[model samples]
Target chain A: MHLNYYQKEDQVLLAVDCIIFGFDKENLKILLIKRNFEPEKGKWSLIGGFLKKNENLDEAAVRVLETLTGLNDIYLEQIHTYSKIDRDPGQRTISVAYFALIDVDSHHFDGIQIDAAHWFDIKEAPNLIFDHNEMVQKAKARLKRRALSKPIGFELLPEKFTMRQLQNLYESILDKKLDKRNFINKINSLDVLIKLDEKDMSVSRKGAYLYVFDKDKYEKKVEEDGFIFKI
Target chain B: MHLNYYQKEDQVLLAVDCIIFGFDKENLKILLIKRNFEPEKGKWSLIGGFLKKNENLDEAAVRVLETLTGLNDIYLEQIHTYSKIDRDPGQRTISVAYFALIDVDSHHFDGIQIDAAHWFDIKEAPNLIFDHNEMVQKAKARLKRRALSKPIGFELLPEKFTMRQLQNLYESILDKKLDKRNFINKINSLDVLIKLDEKDMSVSRKGAYLYVFDKDKYEKKVEEDGFIFKI
Candidate 1:
């Protein structure tokens, strides 16, 4: 194919922005970075970078996340694309936004990069640079919708978690207090968890039973009946 | 800002392809045009064009659709962006795929363009150029999911339609047989429809009551409580 066919078309910059979501014991937080480059020099912003010539958007997103967080093989989903004419003041660049879920305690943050990156509670995150705040809001909404039908919430939890911990994670993400009995009932109906023999003794004297997500069973159920994990 | 800042980066060609969906009485169809340009000339393909320098991706998609259908303000949604390195054979181009829903009986088709553009039942659509077949599959899946939670199915129907026509639209898009009684029960529970005294006798001897989607009521209900219209 002749390159001249596309020569007349305008070539624009493409960037990828990552909305890193983390869940601690009490809050849902987002990983934000302080911009150290021109155009937004000192403002808070999403961890982002321009797409390279040899890489696709997903690879660019993964590279950006790995460069900042020192994490690999994390849960990442493409949520939306932002393409306003002046979204980026530096140029007319289009950005693909990805939402990533990582356990708050699992990743190792580079000390130098850690100085610029911080996990802020979702509600407390400051106004971000350019259209990044809008990107974060869209990612959060996608996360909320996805959590209702998929077992992706497990990506935010540790390998072994207590029932109360699971409920707290949902309540934090959904931003609503759920009835304990009702929540438990709905989760049990999904039948995608393995109740372990051990118990977590840190939160209470009696201890709540620990449960782990049963991936095999979930896949089987999904294949059998198009199962929807609703809470 | 100096253009030299991004001059070293490899600029890529961006294109937008529209999956135009239309619903007839008994089938769901997609509009595909025969490509008249090189690198797959004369092959059936989705209506597509490269993004110009001054235009956003959405604008490009609308331009492509309007050029063929001469319709504006249709229900167009950005479904996904395909950026595989070799998905397009002609060049390293990233295509944003949009799914548009149009009332088949409402839009006017230009006679000259109609000679090259044809509507094919989605299931019977010819092998499309590039990865457009895959794009259609992805858009169809999204349309199925969106129809269940949102009232977007109305976009494929006329302003006034009968309950039977509505159920048929859902069945065709879902590619399944639905229990009529159960479908009506679910739609009525949502309480977002106005049953009119008028009747449509075209499909049956006795005529079914016509209904119109109540956009205002639906929005109000959505605001009051997080409404999930499950079928």
Candidate 2:
């Protein structure tokens, strides 16, 4: 079965990088890895690895994320491909950047020692390695646009959250002010939130009522008529 | 000068398959090529090619479109990457799909001998060669979503287009009946269109006012305060 039909064409390595996004109470943070490879060794970078021959791109992304964060079955999306000639100084490689959303408290992760991997406030994140800064910027932009139309924000928040918590997540990612009345009014109109009798008493003495996202109701509402969750 | 680190890593043969989207006076059509190579010889396929070492993915996509249709500098976007194992029987090829919108009447193309490249109405498009049909479907869905938020539909239309033609393009792609007043209201709010002094008497007796897309004004308006062109 060995043949020369493919022998002439160029063969190279492909890599997958994951931009892990997490929402902490009122701020958005991205999980960044400290590089452990040559050419850009000891610099802050996204969690990434070279793709193996047998694995497809999706499988490679999932494998890299799992190997890095040790979490599986999380929400991940392939956002864009970065294929500049000198994108990776180590070699000629094309990378597909995937942005992932996860509930911060849900996943358990161990930090890589010496080589620094930690959460940075997205607004004040450090200058990243290589073209990773550009990838991060693109991922943030995609998330901001996606959050406007879909209920993906829930993925970043805990299962049960206060309306104020949800609004703060929106404000942090968009980096702009939103009218409190208008924001709450928009969310309430959607009618996909199940108000719990419990209250989040930490922030204010006059605690805000806690609410859980009703996925069934959201899907039903979408099927009946499209609803844009704009803030 | 022949020292170390100047060597390029093994480079993969990057390929770009453009889902060339076009809208005629009536239906939506996609441009395709009949395969000429050994693995899948003589099969319906998307217009595509392997990237030369010097070019970027966008450049490769443009080159393929131009060589196939004698057109260049088309409106294109990299939608997603297809790297499923055995997705391409020829080799373990990683192909990136670009969604290109073009005006159907502008290009004067002659079919190649071995490659029977042709345009088929979206409804009647044949079963494409490989994973191309899946790529086409994804591109169409992405285009439909994009048409709502952006004024890219103008790229698929003639320079001075009637309002009816614009509305029909949306309806055909989305396969939904739109109310006249509601559609007009949504479009007017975006303020991206410049109503020309001329009228197109061909479509109707009353003559719809021909409109052109104002790129500069749209950019300025979006920067000042964003507007969403919802479908």
Candidate 3:
């Protein structure tokens, strides 16, 4: 399989950029890392690294995550790729954007090289480097769509979360007010959650019951009849 | 501006692949071309070409679509990139998949060369080359989601379409048997359609009224208040 026909085509640098989405109490935050390289040195940029040899985009994303956060084994999905000729001013590079949702407190960070990684409130994010702001916008759109159609939002929040936290997470991502009753009705109709005999009273006087996604039951039901989790 | 640090990294081939979706009457079809190149010659493949020096990914997608359809100015969007190590059995190449919607009868076939290009009924599409089938599935999923949340479905269908045709298109894409009365009620409630007096008598004796999406009105109303067109 010779496959050398495209060898002479303009070979441009490729980057794997990650948008780490995390949820804190009420607001959604995006992780930004200070660029250590010369092109955008010290400027706030997405957590990114050049795709290394022998690594595919997913592995590259995981490597980027591990390099920045000192953590692995997270949910990362390739959202879209940005390849405008001038997206990166320093060179003609194509960047494949991935969105990763990790529970904020789950991954530990040692006091070392990973200090540059910090979570910023999505609305208050600093001026980003290159076309990263556009990437964030696109990632947010994908997150919103995924949140509505699937149960992936649970990945961003804590494993055991109250119903209010879930609702707030949706509202933060969607930037719209959702009726509590209507939201609960819609979510409950999906029949994919398991109510644990636990309550979290941190945010309210009357504690809310905690729930965890029943993965096995959900997977079975999803296979039997597509359990659409409409938001 | 010295990118010398990355000069030694693996410079793999990059290509833009397109899933051209077209709607004929009520059938949702995708335009696919047979591969005539070495690695997978004479097999069913996606419409694709390698990224050029001066062109971006979107530009490459447009170029590939124009080259295949012999026409320019089509609606195309970058869905996701496939970067699995063995996705392309011939070599380790990264492919950015773009999904496009084109009017069925509007493309020009002049000056286009390669293996045969034809529309495929999505469900019955043959075994494609490499991971092309997965790309098609993702594109169809995006199309269905977009159809429900935006006015993209109208791009695939003709300017004027009967309610039954539109409903059938939705049914075909979503792979569900929707109740006719409920489907009509939901679409009518959207208030973005202009119902003409013409009836489509081709499909039935009673016929259905012809309607075209009022672009200006739909744009205006969607801006003022979000719309959800569902079946």
Please report the candidate that would top TM-score against the real structure.
1
C-alpha RMSD of each candidate structure in angstroms: 2.3, 3.3, 3.2
Candidate 2 residue B227 C-alpha distance from true site, Å: 3.8
A108-198: candidate 3 lDDT, tens digit per residue: 7652347888889888999999999998998888787566556555577777888888888888988889999999998787777889998
Model 3: chain B TM-score relative to the native chain B: 0.90
* Candidate 1 lDDT over residue span B1-231, tens digit each: 545565655677889999999987667899999987778889999988888877788999888788776777887889888888888777788889998998888888863356789889888999999999999999988888666656655678889988888888888777888998999998888788999999998878989899999989776654542345555
- Cα lDDT of all candidates, in order? 0.82, 0.78, 0.79
Error of 1 at A122 (Å): 1.0
TM-score of 1: 0.93
Ranking by TM-score: 1, 2, 3
**Candidate 3, B116: how far from true, in Å?**
2.3
The residue ranges of model 1 lying beyond 4 angstroms of the native Cα positions read A220-231, B1-4, B111-113, B219-231
Off by over 4 Å in 2: A1-5, A111-115, A219-226, B1-13, B110-115, B204-208, B218-226
Best by lDDT: 1
CAPRI class of candidate 1: acceptable
**How would you encode candidate 2's per-residue C-alpha lDDT over B1-231 as one tens digit per residue?**
211332432334567899988888567788887776667777888998776667677888888888777777688899998888778777777899998888788756753432477888888898887799899989988887666655656678888887788888888787788988898888777778999999988767988899988888666654542335656
Model 1, residue B212: distance off in Å is: 1.9
